[model samples]
Target chain A: MIPNLTLAVVAGVLFATGVYLLLARSITRALLGIVLLSNGANVLLLVAAGPAGEAAFYGRTPESDMSDPLPQAMVLTAIVITLGMTAFILAMAHRSWQLSQTDIVADDVEDLRLVELAVRDVAPHDEERPDVDDDAAGDDRPPGPGTDAVVEP
Target chain B: MTGIDWDILVPLPVVLALAGAGVAVVVTGRIRLQRAVSVVTLSLVLVVALALLVGADREGPLSVTVGGWPARMGVVLIVDRLAALMLVVSATVTLGVLLYSIGQGAASTDEERADEQAPLPIFHPTMLVLSAGVSNTFITGDLFNLYVGFEILLASSFVLLTLGGSAPRIRAGISYVVVSLLASVILLSAIAMLYAATGTVNMAQMAERLDALPEGTRLVLQLMLLVAFAVKAAVFPMFGWLPDSYPTAPAPVTAVFAGLLTKVGVYSIMRTQTLLFPGDQLTELLMWAALATMLVGILGAVAQDDIKRMLSFTLVSHIGFMLFGVAVGTAAGISAAIFYVAHHITVQTTLFLVIGLIERYGGTTSLTRLGGLAKLAPVLAVLFFLPAMNLAGIPPFSGFLGKAGLLQAGAEQATWLAYLLIAGSVLTSLLTLYAIARVWSRAFWQPPIEPATEGLERVPRGMTLPAAALVAVGLAITVVAGPLFAVTDRAAADMLERAPYIDAVFPGGVP
Candidate 1:
């Protein structure tokens, strides 16, 4: 059985490595850091429980019995969840890269300015306005009438 | 023998699984079929949930031993009134959101096929999975099961968060994923420590064992658990990821996520504080955290010009009110928290749906770009009014009633801590009103810009119906405040009196 202190030490090393990866600039590396941190935490959980025999993914043996099952179950759930999240984050990175040809976050100011410029630069309906004017002229109102009312005139 | 047996809870998970299967079929490539199935399944789930609540309301703690194993050895699904009532509320809001989503699609004629790389194909199934996970979290009698449930919902949320793969969304998703992962690890480690010390993972069993552990060990376990759940709940300092991530999701997704997800975290916190470590020490830490979260959330809301982002910040801020109830560690406070959570979910989701409607009509969510919507869509204006007031906790609304209950409880204790909570609630309410007024003045009251009007006035029928329906729901709750508060009061009582829960799981009592 490993000493509790030694197990904790190993877990601490894992956590340090995980934290370093988490602080990296790359999104992918950061995700890896999350994975490592979770595993480290899992190890810490095991250490907290005390010495346990090695347990295979599917086995009924002394090795499995020696380890705490609850943390193991939690670890399994965390692993599955991490897998889904990592995949989603990678997909996002790919999309962001596609949109801007860069993986780093882009500023929205340029996009906003472009939209403003487009609104200001173009007249959307010049031809249509003259058509509306010609149509209005064919209506039944008397042209250049000076009277306030027809009866008064 | 003549009464309802309190030993039957596992079947609720089965019903949820069935609902998920129905949703899976709908989302697997059939758009029309998906809408039908989603609505029908949601309605059925809601009905069953209500039945569970009423049946379990007066009954003692209801537990179902899974796979015929004893409670100590096997997984147990317990349905106390609190769990059952939360299930019903979750189902109700999910139904409302689903209807709104379908209505929006129909209005836009986008019902046939979503835009290129549009994410509805995957969204519906994941939402069902998310619902199932939530139900499991409430029902399970064990801590490990709760951890597993959190993972299930969190995984689904990753897809839901970045559904469209927009640039901002991607950036937001990265932070959200990392933070949630860290919390999960911390939670797992805590679970490990508990099992090691107690040789059991069942929450009921752990509560019994926890009392016997050394004070230092117990405090460490408690702190670790609180930190983990707090991160999930988006409590004050740990809430950085929520505002950025939530605003980037599609409107319906945002509404549902806003309504239920963090509340689950708060629910867990309530359970942990009450069950595992029932004392004053943790409440002090929680009380301060609640005040900070309340203050920080509203202040952030006031600063945002984007409608969705502002709502997300408020979502974080209001969590403090619920936490305040739990921090008081009294029956009245917990009950108030229950009531507050129920009301907040409806009000928050409705407000988000209204924002979606504004975007549909005004062509942008930016306050600077939006104006004079009331003249164009009076219905939309009316819809926005109810939830906005409700969120600000104005009189005659569920929000006010819930806040009043929380305040009353705080006053009963009347400590400096309670005073801080009261002051924070009042301040948060005022700031919330200010935020809502900003939205109103910018989006509804001012004259419309000619530039903003071209190609922007067209609101699809699909979208309008959902927005209108959500508004109606907000008003309905306001009208029916009496029944809702009664339900909340009952739920709060059930949670505080722990005997029903403990007795249900271990009929033969603890060893």
Candidate 2:
């Protein structure tokens, strides 16, 4: 039987990679990060159930020697949930491509501006943009929505 | 040993919401019919919740063990004072938000073209599903069932958040979904660990088994559970997604999200801390988080010039107040936290709905563009004013009462951290007051910076009525704070002592 150590180590590797990628600037990499992270969590869930013993089906093995079925069931449910989430996120990433040119998760304009201010140690700048002011009671810079300075091609 | 009477009530709220969702989906083409179904389902849920509250209060905790499986093998639904009280409050808030959404939806359908209102048909069904998820989270006795409830809510919210199909909504939805999915994965893994550490997932059974575990192991499990929940609750250091995500959703979606979702996380923390890992082993950590969340959240609020972002930060800040009470580990503190959650849900949702009105009337939520609103829409001004002050913990409001009770509890403990939290709580409240005042002065008091290019539309009666109703309900909580606190105190007492809950489930001695 595979020991908990191997499982845990693999899980750790997956998690480390996932987190590293998650911190990446690209949305696709972040999506990949989510996939790896969820899979790692699933593996950990299995490890949490202890070393495998016997088949889950009744009469195939004595009940005492049977592997815990709850975690398996939980893992199944988690996998399904992760599937749905991944698909949804993929759609969002696709939409980002359609609407804008890039697949990077841009920070909202306010977030980007704050980062800009910190880096340059300069005062804020207000710039005009498309989209925010639609009607008559417009003209205020409603933060020009989200974009990252570093994310530009 | 299971009584069939309360057994039926345990699943009723969730069942009604889901069944209603099913019917609403079938009637989705007709927005009017869908609205009718949504209202009826939530209203029925509210009525059932009130009955559950009365039953639980009068008859101690009632439980239903699913499928008659032996003790640790099956799911259990518990209706205790704490669960019942949360059920009632959550149902009330969801129902109020549903009505408000209908109003907003109807208003938009009347004015906007096809593309804008395209998603309105599905909104009612999804809203029902969200309500079911919330109800399930509150009532379920087992941990995995609660996780299922969270998933239900998360899926529905993922849809609701991106309803408008606008760029910002999708961007914000991506953040929301990613954060929530991460939290769900962590929560599932933690449950697996908890089940492995103990031999069961039935909470009562696990509590008994976990008592025998090594101290270090118990602490590990406790921390895992806490971290998982902290992410959901938007506690400090884990709340990065909230302000970014919530402010971009449609108003009703944001209102409901602001009102209930994070509170469900807080509710779970309360439950687990009291049941499986009782006492103050994690109190020090929770206390620091409490202080940090309050201070950081309020400071975020102060820095925002947009109404939605400002309100979102205030929401984060106020969660700190509830966590503070939980950290205190005293009956008064826990009760006060519960009371504060109730007050915050109503006031937060009301403020968001009011902001929706302001956005509509002024054509923007940016404080820089908004002003002379008090002169234009006095009804809207009053609606915004009452809840804004209430949220800031103004006197004679439930917010003030809840904070006062929490501060009194912390002071009684007399710990240095508790004292620091006390000071933090007061400072946070004042800062919140200042933040709202910034909005008031810039948006309502000052004359409009520019002449109106178009006349402001009178807010639809439907919209104002629901917002006003919630504000009045908040006022009712203040006016009747005495009885409410008494109920809260009793609920808190029942929650802190695990014996009654366990005994009710197992009949005789705990398993």
Candidate 3:
């Protein structure tokens, strides 16, 4: 069966652009990237169906004239999955924005701490390990008397 | 012989879990009822899965076409030895983890506040959906259906990972979601290409058709599938997302994800390799990948200060052992890999659950803050110690048996690369021991850094009981090692032969 060159090219473009956007630091851009990549995949599925012919309804079209119905069915499933995932990611992005007031994805705190230790050439398990515990505990600790004294002054 | 229709039960694990999820969602406000629904559902799944395992082993394989559709035209759910084994192991762990989480939920919040508090009402339904996804992947005979199964689990995992919309979890979830999505896209593209080449996505039919393709085209298709599965499996160079994301989730979430998710990827790799590819073309490449995954993952583990993250790294490392077995490309090797997968799933989940107890008892997971736990909580120490030793491949534990099997398989292969992998496996085992020993000394044996904090409530028995039960299950594996090995041996032989699976799916031969 002859393949669809135009659709293949479009899928290629979509993949390239999608990957480019996917590498961005912003969550919104990454979500768009996922959307584009899934669409690209969907298009590739379409291209896999070969040259278009009569719609695949049996009895309505002769068997030989019908386009491959399987890939079309697959493409539909991919579209629905992509739509669901897109909605989920959008909700996550919105939640991230609500919590951080920034759309940029944050670095993992533990990973960042490891990096900081590496930059300082200190072993992570060493007793001299940086007191980064402050970051984790800062949110939960009650206010100290020193802070209250300064405020009273 | 008993007149039981075992064929009808092949799809029950997935169907039951999914239907249970719907019922669970309906009973959202009634926490006890929701929990009962999930437990009952998974218990039923365990029963069905056990029956399938026995039937598949005794009968070769059992298959059912969904909705009575023709095998060539519709989805198939086939339970051969390999799939049945996976179903049984996964069902056990999901049930175990669910009970542990229920216990944890009770301990962390009083019943009056449970309806409005954490462990949110969404957990039970999502957990059931996740189980259904995992079971679906294990049993699916259609490639596209396998993709759907993956999406089902992944979507649920995303929700579980970021449950409660906490800031740290959301940060981790973003990376996890993106990486998993990318893998899904690649897997989809590969399936499309395979369908284009073979004209069908039914694995049995594709197995027949793939052989007739030109070598280059077949190789390309194989590589595409490998890349997708490798990322999901968290193999070397693609595993960055795992260590960063897994440790931030709630303990039970982390446990279940660590236990089952990567193994699902490994399971798919094994299926595609044995059934579809069935050659030594990529075995060398996989062997090298296995070596790297083992060494790098353990080294990362050795450097971690947090117990959860350290275990997460070790989890990645053990995936390499399974990969090594698969790479050996022999019946013995594949059997060892299957056993390793089952052993790892139980031990890893148990360890994580124990760590959850550790976190609660010590008021932290950081090694620096934890001390004198052996004296303070002897039961918790034993709970941690048994699995820790098992994970470190101590003799008489399933971990040691699994590793010894892989090492012996590698030796039997006797290729230079296989020898190298054997050495790598041994070294990784040593490092795992070292990592566990360090945690033991620092967290349990060391003197308290600050005297144990006062008013710390005793660990609820509800939580400890399930964790203890899982530990006992880990030991039980060792006790039954011989029989388990025989089962895995039969399963491996069948997988390598490939006929049992194909014949089950298409008894009349590929149309």
lDDT string, candidate 2, B274-348, tens digits: 888987888999999999999999999999879999999999999999999999989999999999998998899
lDDT of 3 by residue, A1-153 (tens): 688999999999999999999998889999999999999999999889998999988899999899988999899999999999999999999998899788888767554564444434433323444564433333223332111111110
Q: Candidate 1 DockQ score?
A: 0.31
Where does candidate 2 stray beyond 4 Å? A1-3, A115-153, B1-3, B109-120
TM-score of each model's chain B: 0.95, 0.97, 0.98
Native-referenced Cα lDDT, model 3: 0.90
Query: For candidate 1, lDDT tens digit of each residue in A48-107?
Result: 666665564445565645555655665666667667766766777678678657544432
DockQ of each: 0.31, 0.48, 0.64
Report the C-alpha lDDT of model 3 over B1-511, residue by residue, as the tens digit: 2314989898899999999999999999898999999999999999999999999989888889999999999999899888998999999999999998898887775653353234558999999999999999999999999999999999999999988788888889999999999999999999989988998999999999999999999999999999999999999989999999999888889999999999999999999999999899999999999999999999999999999999999999999999999999899999999999999999999999999999877779999888888998999999999999999999989999999999999999998999999999999999999999999999999988887569356888888999999999999999999999999999999988888899888887889
Q: What lDDT tens digits, residue by residue, belong to model 1 across residues B231-269?
A: 999998899888878887878889999998899999899
Q: lDDT winner among the candidates?
A: 3
The Cα local distance difference test for each model comes to 0.78, 0.85, 0.90
- lDDT of model 3 at position B326: 93
Give lDDT: candidate 1, residue B212.
98
* DockQ, candidate no. 3: 0.64
List the candidates' TM-scores in order: 0.87, 0.93, 0.94
Candidate 1: deviation at residue B75, Å?
Answer: 1.6
